[model samples]
Target: MHILVDRITEKTGLDPEKVEPAVGIMLNFIAKNSTREEVETLLEAFPAAEGFLAIDEATENKGLFGGLASKMNASVGVLAALNEMTTLGLTVEDIQKVAKETVEYTREKAGPEFTDEIVARVPGLAEIT
Candidate 1:
């Protein structure tokens, strides 16, 4: 997980701390939308992925300018995840880079088929580029 974060940080030029939450929120969105079998396969492939999806009180507190995001009716998806990453001062291009790095890394670790299934299932995920 840290390796993924590191790669995204380096690729996107975002801070490591900022990258963590971004990764968490994105992973949370992906896991939430994935089928049970898909989620199980992803978890089996990357044990630390569950940790990335876990949102603590601290992370929840940071949502949408100190939790305003929770007040809004926003479903976790590619757009929502991009909004979260943008709040961390990332441009759309940066967000795209992060998305690319994330997908590529997951493909490497979890296999291309699993990664492709995830991207295909998540709404607007293919548009990240």
Candidate 2:
């Protein structure tokens, strides 16, 4: 849902003053959260985002600020895993195997892209001795 918002914001190229109202209207529909069930029902009727929001305490607490932050963190984790797997010369199956393992292991010092790119540069990286 936030991803869709970013795309819309970019495409419309509207300033915050204009964009915020549109955003409020959209998120309001997605959450459909109100003190009264009838209001929530009316809100859900808008048809803007009935099934998209998978909200919970953490996501709800961020109040629209945390979703993007969470996406960035997820991106970092994925890139880090890619870096480790590539440099280790993990084959497709190896990568598939290590993906679960990578979740158990994360590098705090370096991005995986750095390691993967370096491995690609080494002449013998793809071949084993």
Candidate 3:
């Protein structure tokens, strides 16, 4: 997890502290938007992803308004994830960099076949990463 987080920080120039939660939010969004089989393969390839997912779950809706905001954004997947990432101080470019690095890392850990399958299946994913 540290290795991946370090790699993201090095490449994206984002704060090390922000990388984990950002990645977690992105992964959670991907998992929600993808098929069950795709998610299983993704998780299998990157077991550390579970920890990131937990991070997102833990910090999802905190304040009084956060819960309402989350509910309003629930039907809008990418928008919600984008909101969460921005809340963490990540810019659009930063998010893209993180997503690309994450995808590249996944390709290295898993295989191009596995990574490509997930990307192709998930809408709006290829545009970013």
Candidate 4:
């Protein structure tokens, strides 16, 4: 909480004392299931000390965080795809060789969403495995 307040205060030119309690309460709330006092404290719009930490802790437990997870996976996939092409010298012409085999595999294992998601994330890799 202190670290966050210091950083935020330094950046925003606000007093660290003003935000520390709020951030601490927010963090506590995030760590717990939460209560009314915390909610009331947060409604005041004071960016609390533990806001980022609490969010990190809360989100750490949720596996199906759909948007954030998808975005993170998409970023990784895109980087990998680019790396495969650039570092491995996978050419535009090689795309043809990969296309047919991928379609066959997709047809064989149709239910898994991972295949479709990876394809979408990696752009031209849709027709590759």
Candidate 5:
């Protein structure tokens, strides 16, 4: 997790504290939308990943009004993660840079073949990178 946080920080100039939760949101988003094999590969490459895989339902659904009345949901998976990242004060360009750097880091850690396989399984990931 630190590795990912560091990589994101290095690539995006985001604070480590903010990067931590941003990456967690992305990992949780991926785990929700990806296949078991896809998630398992990432977990194997990044053991600390499991800690971030669970989405907090309370936080996930909370809205401006902090209740169902104002609860407008972001699109699921990477889009949702991207939306959350924006709340952390990142621009779309920063998100794209972060996404590309993340994939590059994963490729270095887990090999291109494995990383590519994982990316192929996640919807809209290609668009982001």
Candidate 6:
């Protein structure tokens, strides 16, 4: 995870702290929209993924409106994740860079087959990443 974060930080010029949350948001979006089996494979390939998801969950559930926001996230899909990332001070371009780097990191950790399947399965993900 450190290695991946370093790579994204170096390549995207995003803050180190922002990288994890951005990546986590993208991963959570993917998980929510893709097949369970494919997502499981992704989690297996990136075991630290669970930690990232947990962090995102904790961050999302932090305030009075957190619970409601989380529920809205479920119903709203990628928009919710995008909103979360933006709240972390990321722009659309930053988000795309993070998504691309994350997918590339997953490919390196897993394989093209595993990464490709998830990206293809998740609608609009191809365009974003």
Query: Estimated TM-score per prediction?
Result: 0.79, 0.21, 0.84, 0.26, 0.73, 0.83
- lDDT for each residue of candidate 1 in 8-124, tens digit (9 for 90 to 100): 877667888777777776676677677888888888888878888774224544434445434543344455567777777777887777777877877887899889877886777
User: Each candidate's lDDT (Cα)?
Assistant: 0.71, 0.33, 0.78, 0.38, 0.66, 0.78
lDDT minimum window of 10 residues, candidate 6: 61-70
Residue-by-residue lDDT tens digits, candidate 6, 27-114:
7777777677877887888898888777776777433344453466444556667677888888899999999998998999889988
Candidate 6, residue 46: CA error in Å? 1.4
Model 2 poorest ten-residue lDDT run = 100-109
RMSD of each: 3.2, 20.2, 2.9, 20.4, 4.3, 2.9
Candidate 3 similarity to native, TM-score: 0.84
lDDT score of model 2? 0.33
Off by over 4 Å in 2: 1-11, 14-33, 55-58, 62-129
**Local accuracy of candidate 2 as per-residue lDDT tens digits, 73-125:** 43332333333334434444443332222211111112355334433432332
Shift in Å, residue 8, candidate 6: 0.5
Winner on lDDT between 5 and 6 is: 6
Q: Candidate 6: global Cα-lDDT?
A: 0.78
Q: Compute the lDDT of residue 5 as modeled in candidate 6.
A: 82
lDDT of 5 by residue, 25-110 (tens): 66665666667887787789877777655533325633223333223332344555677767767778877776777677768876
Runs with alpha carbons beyond 4 Å of true place in candidate 3: 62-75
| Best-to-worst TM-score order | 3, 6, 1, 5, 4, 2
Which residue pairs come into collision in candidate 4? 23-48, 23-49, 23-50
